[model samples]
Target chain A: MKTSNKSVNQEAKNSFSIKGYFLRHIQVCLASLGRICRSPVSSLMTIAVIAISLALPAGMHVLIKNIEYVTSGWDGAAQISLFIKKGTTEEKVVNLKNQIELMGQIDKTEYISPTSALEEFKRLSGFGQALDALDKNPLPAVIVISPGIEASSPQQLNQLVESLQDNPIVDHAQLDMQWVKRLYSIMDIINRGVMIVGALLALAVILITGNTIRLDIQNRHDEILITKLIGATNSFIRRPFLYTGILYGLLGGIIASVLIGLSIGLLSDSVSKLSSLYSSGFELKGLGVDGTFTLIAGSTALGFAGSWVAVGKHLGKIEPS
Target chain B: MIRFDNTTKRYSEGHEALSSISFDLNEGEMSFLTGHSGAGKSTLLKLIACIERPTRGQVVVNGVNISKLRKSKIPYLRRNIGIIFQNHQLLFDRTVFDNIALPLVIQGLPHREIGRRVRAALDKVNLLGKEKLYPVTLSGGEQQRVGIARAVVHKPPIILADEPTGNLDPELSAEIMHLFEQFNQVGVCILIASHDIDLLNKMNKRIITLQQGKIIYDGHEMAPKSYHNHENIQ
Candidate 1:
């Protein structure tokens, strides 16, 4: 009975120690955050540095996404206009349209008879009187083929045009691909630029955070030595600094999110107005929940990694000698 | 209990701090170490605390051979030994209460237990009312008292102090010695290193004197014909 009671008491003490462990970590986290709050100017400066670095890439990424959205909207109406051979009858043009429509790669195909094609051109061209003086109809029957929505890339559209050009009755296949290629190339360049800038800025964030943490370690040099002398584990000495880094990272992430949100809010109105002028339904996209979470999570991770590196390098050098 | 068997500490700079010195301090015993400025007194204490491992030989503190102990186990070993520095090493940023509560906090004690023990330690050191005051606001003696409070708060079995009263007046130094006596009465083994011959002679405890990285004198305190006999020093 005595041994059993002793074991039970020991178990209680063990549980209490476990509880204290978590409680201590929570206390350290709060204390570190409070320290940052106490030094608002310096903390804000550090956070601003981090936020700017984060926001540049994140904002550029959003811009790229919006640009892609606009381009895709423009590409939706893109079709390959295949002018049928002049000697071909309207029956051959309709049959070609039917055949193209039945093709798996074509979403839909429309056939315009020679008379209607000439008539529609005459109505819009403002050269109607001049065009009526012609002895024979100059316009050919045309088949306009829209590629499947799955063919999103310019390369895919070009391939569709190439296939349509191979039709025997087709005299010419025309696709306005210059603008599409330019848009894609521009987007590609910007995307790569964003990645390079993001990577470099990410490295900068790590170095900035690391240097700050190193300075903190130096400032708290005496405190760290005292704690170590008093049997504080290296982990205990390291905990507060880690939390400080995490706080900096989390705050920077939040600030970047806010900056991106404000910029989007500022530009969204003009962008939508311009879209209306062009009869396109494009809108600026802000960092959504996932984006905001990723920003914060990513920054916090950078902070953690930076501080981990700093502490691991410097904490071992300090001893209560 | 502390035992050193032929311990030696040689720094990376090729300077030998403590060389093949051996000593045994039993449980609950109080002693003083005396030496000149560079007599390896601090190095010996540091070795026992596991702050610096000995270059050669073994250190067994409280039945554990700590010379071979892993770096990961150093903190656990130090938790059983409380050390006081000459400078007190109190953090100026925190209040005396937090300073005194450091050891217990390091142990991850509950806040209530930490509060109870910190107050108890402060009461013992006669600095109970100054808990809210920062270390910089305290006098030399009071700062040393705060260091003592921190050292004892965790109730470790062995206490080591390195020139703890180095900055205090004779009166305050005696008072600090009185405090150590009070702790020694409760069976806390203590080893204090000091250069003050007057205080060492007055305490009448065992004296272990070091000279140039070696133990030259390790015996009971012997009183001279006159307590002020300067010629009989060392």
Candidate 2:
């Protein structure tokens, strides 16, 4: 009997010390979730505000990513144009093209003879009759060298152009990098703007969650007092509120993901049409798995932080007086 | 199990709620604190529960000098104490069982254990079948009995009640006092604050009467029950 009693005591102690902690947390977590569900209208209103706040920034980020994707295909336009010297032999032009192609920075080199260059220019410039007036072609044989994607930055392109200009057979080498630089600068500005807006919206989410929790604490004033009187620790009283905040954050993140998906679906057709008109195959991209996960995790953390602040500020003010 | 040594509690408003009050109630002892309204009965009980700190001297419970206890340690101290209020502060939103199980839940007891103990406490208070009912639906006396069940559910060593029978009729008040007596029989020290002279006379327990923040009487020996009744009438 003594041995059995001792074992029973040990079992009780172990259960209370280890499993009891997790049990209490799980109970509170579910209880807070149930409380939110009991008041669906109010809970949804809070969640909707949080979702819109999260969706605005998340949508802008996805838009920026898609814009970057579309612009990446235009990188080939920043090619370097090398004008061969007049009276250069065809064999020498061919040799120059072979040498430029062998260089790692040059992706491909196209050799345009003077005859084809003049013909293309006449066709594009609408000066065929005038060009026919001249006996010899005045256009130089040109070699358009497209740089490798890795070497397409403005500085890399400038360096490649300068080195080609040093060639004795090249008259002038030009790179149309102005537009590329302008596009990158615009993207940078927009990215910075998105960051600022995201930060402001995140703060809004925190404030909204905090205010909701504060009202909840007020509504449960007597409950808190009675709980405190019965010997509840500050952490014990704060657990349910913290769980409530986290639930709000989690639901908000899920709704934001859905909203982003809906908006993407709505705009995808228009985006594809516009791209097809531009003769490009760009498609709108939605928030992928990683993005959704990050959004939910981030919003949950924000919720925890918001409730931490509110609980810290309010729970202490309530005593058993 | 509880002691007070020249304890004084002065509010910030310059009113002394308890002054130089001293008493000792041993383990398994049951006592009554009686006086007119605002005569320091509630304040004395609050000091024992550490809800209000004594402005001077020591207030001790279970051998701990609660006057010097840390804020974080107060909860642990209170876990060994059960307090019932005059208003029977029950959460109307929860069922009677949930209300009674609160202290055990705070202590992180197992679910099955909490249910067993809550029912046992309810049985003790004769409120066993009303576990699922909300407090608002219960009568005033029944509600106070639920409060009593909640206080003793955790089986704390000390039980302090401040006018727990204030709203109950004479019969219901006797039933509540009988529950306190039953708890005292099991080695729980009890201190009930009230001004019910007739009830106190019938209990014949130690009665500590306070007048204007000072103890005027502190024993069961009475100078003629009629004289005490006359004093109350005056």
Candidate 3:
């Protein structure tokens, strides 16, 4: 009975110690955060540095996502009209339109009469007198064909053009796609550039946090010596510093998030106006929940890791002597 | 309990602070360690505390060869011994209550237990009412008392006080010595090192005096006796 009671008491003590360890960590975290709070100016300045660091990547991320959203439904290549000879009549063009529409892969077919073709040329090319001076209207009755959406890929459209070129009645096949492909490649390069910048900035953030924690450990040398002398475990002594790092990172993440949001807000009007010049009302995007969470989590993790590394190195140098 | 066998601590540039010396301090007994400034009194305390290991010797504390102990076990050993510094290294940033409660908090006592024990320790040191005051607000002697209160707050088995009253007047010094006596009466083994012969004569405890890295005397306190070529020790 006595042995059983002793073992039971031992179990209780073990459980108590476990609880004590966890609660002690909470107290340390609180104390660290409290110290930051007490020094408001320095804390804000530190947080602002973090925020700026996080903002660079976060802002780029928003811009990329917005660009993706804007260009999501755009087609790289668009079909054009193939003008027939002037001698061709409405019957000739209608015959060609009907023939093209009957094809399995053709999306749309339009037949323009000689008179309508002449009016379109005058309006589009601004050559009304030349369009009207001709005795019998020198323009051709044209047949325009747009490929099926499913068959709109570059290879498929090329095959369709080849088939069109083989037609005896058509004069030419055309496409308006030169500038679109260039724009796409430009966007791709920019997206990759943004990712590289983000990675480099993340490294800078870690270095900032590590150096800050190093200074903090130096400042608290006396406290650390006292703590070690009193039998405080290394983990116990390190907890508050780690928490301080985490706080700095989290606050910085928040600041960065806000900065990104405000930047997006400020840019939204200008971007929309610019998009309108392109006849598109594309709006700039703000950071969503995942973005906010990533900023916070990434910054916090960096803070924790930086402090851990700095504190571990510096803590070893402190001799209870 | 502590034992140092053939302990030789040599610093850089060929300075052997403590020569090949040996001694044993049994458990549950009060003793004093005294020497000149460089005679290694503090070094001996530091070695027992495991703050610094002997350069070439074995240190056994509480039946365990602590000198051979791993780095991980150092904290456990320290939790069992309380140390008071000559400068009374109290944190100026913390209140006297929080300062006294440091060791207990480090041990992770419950909040109420921390409050009760810190108050009790402060009461013992006669600094009860100044618990809320910061260390900077306290006098030199009061700060030292706060340090003493913090050292005893966790109720360690052994207490090492290095010149606990070196900076105090004789009246406060005796009062501090009486406090140590009260603690000794409660079965806490204490080792104090000091330079005040007047206080040492009045202490009336077992005294161990050191001179030039050697134990010149170890005996019950009676009266000052002239010794050949030894520094005045208290």
Candidate 4:
């Protein structure tokens, strides 16, 4: 009976201490935040530095996403144009177009009669007077085949063009793939460049936070010394500085998001106008929900890491003496 | 309780601050450590507090050999022993109440318990109603009292003071000594380092004197006159 009573009392004390632990942490967290709020000028300066550093990479990321979005439709533009033999009958050309459209890899096929092809050439090439002086229509009936998305890869497109060129009625089949490959290469390089810049800026953010926290430690040297003398644990002395770091990072992330949002808002109208001028329905994409969340989470983690390093390096040097 | 077994401290600059010093302070024993400024009174207190470790000997506190205590364990050791400084190391940016509440905060005491204990300590130091005032606004005596309140707020079993009354007037210094006597009466072991000959003579407690990093004397009221004469020669 005595042992059971003592066990119950021990449980009560444990629960009480657990509650006290959380209470103390909450107090320290708020006190750190209050310290930042009290010194608005210096705190804002540090936060602004973090926000700008974060914004550069985040802004580049948004630009790349928008660029990818704008160019996404060009994948379907890898069409194969088949020039038919000059004397092929129009009926045979139509039949050939129908046959190609039924192929598994073909999206759709358009047949252009020799007459209409000549007229389109004259209108587009500004050579109507020169064409009128010719004795006869020298143009050939053409069939344009758009490959399905699954078959639009460079190798598949090459295979389709080669197969079409072997047909008796087709004089030549062409697929303009060089420009597409160049576009992809450019995109890959830009993506890699953005990644490098992002990594460097992240390092810069960490260094900035670390330097700010170092200054904070120096400023509170006396407080830290006194607290240590009074039996405050190193963790207790470190708590406020860590919290200050996290708050700086959190606030910086939030402001960077806002900055990105405002810039996207400013650029939206001009981007829409440009796309409309090109007769395309493409729209610019901003940092969506996932991107914003990742930015905030990453910045907060970096802030924690920076302050952790600073605290470990500087807090131990402050002995009670 | 603190026991020093032939403790010696040497700095990296080839200065020996303390050499072959040995002493034993019992539980609930109040004693004064008196010496000239450079005679290593502060250094001895620092060794007991684990702020500095001995270069050569064993310094034991509460039966733990703190001369070789790990760095991570220093804070726990300090929590069991309260230390007061001559400079009255109160945080000037905080209120008197916050300064006194720091030790309890470090111990993770509940909010209500902290308030209750802080008020109790403040009452002891006769600063009951000045909790909201900042330390910078207080008089020197009041500030020193706040430091004392902070040191004892967590109720450690042992207290070590280094020149705690150095900045006070003679009357205020006596009052502080009286406060230490009251704490000692309640079974708290205390060792104070001071060079005030008159104050040490009046306290009527065990006194230990150091000179050139060596104990020249240790006794009660019997050695006051002789100690005074020695100081006059120095």
Ranking of candidates on TM-score, top first? 2, 1, 4, 3
Of candidate 1 chain A, the 10-residue stretch with the lowest lDDT total is: A4-13
Predicted model with the maximum lDDT: 2
Give the per-residue lDDT digits (tens) of candidate 4, residues B1-234.
789999999877878889999999999999999988888898899999888889998888866687656676677777778888899888888999999998887877778999999999999999999999999899999999999999899888899988999999999999999999999999999999999888888889999988878888998864456567777888
Candidate number achieving the greatest TM-score relative to the actual structure: 2
lDDT of each: 0.85, 0.88, 0.81, 0.86
A best-first ranking of the candidates according to their DockQ comes to: 1, 2, 4, 3
i-RMSD per candidate, Å:
7.5, 8.1, 6.9, 8.3
- Listed models, DockQ each: 0.43, 0.40, 0.33, 0.37
Q: Give the per-residue lDDT digits (tens) of candidate 4, residues A239-263.
A: 9999988988999998889999999
Where does model 4 exceed 4 Å of error? A1-18, A81-106, A110-143, A148-174, B224-226
lDDT tens digits by residue: candidate 3, A1-321: 234334333433453466677787788888999999998998788789878988988888888888767764464236657767656666766887888888877768777777787787789999888757677776666777776666755567677777777777677777655555666678879988988888888888888888889998999999989989998778778888899999899889988998998898888888888999999867787889988998899999988888888888898898787
Tens digit of lDDT per residue, candidate 1, span A246-320? 888899999999999999999999989998998877788888899899989999999988888899999899987
What TM-scores does chain A show, candidate by candidate in order?
A: 0.79, 0.80, 0.68, 0.74
Off by over 4 Å in 1: A1-18, A82-93, A102-108, A112-142, A148-150, A155-176, B223-234
Deviation in angstroms for A187 in model 3? 1.7
Local lDDT at A282 for model 3:
75
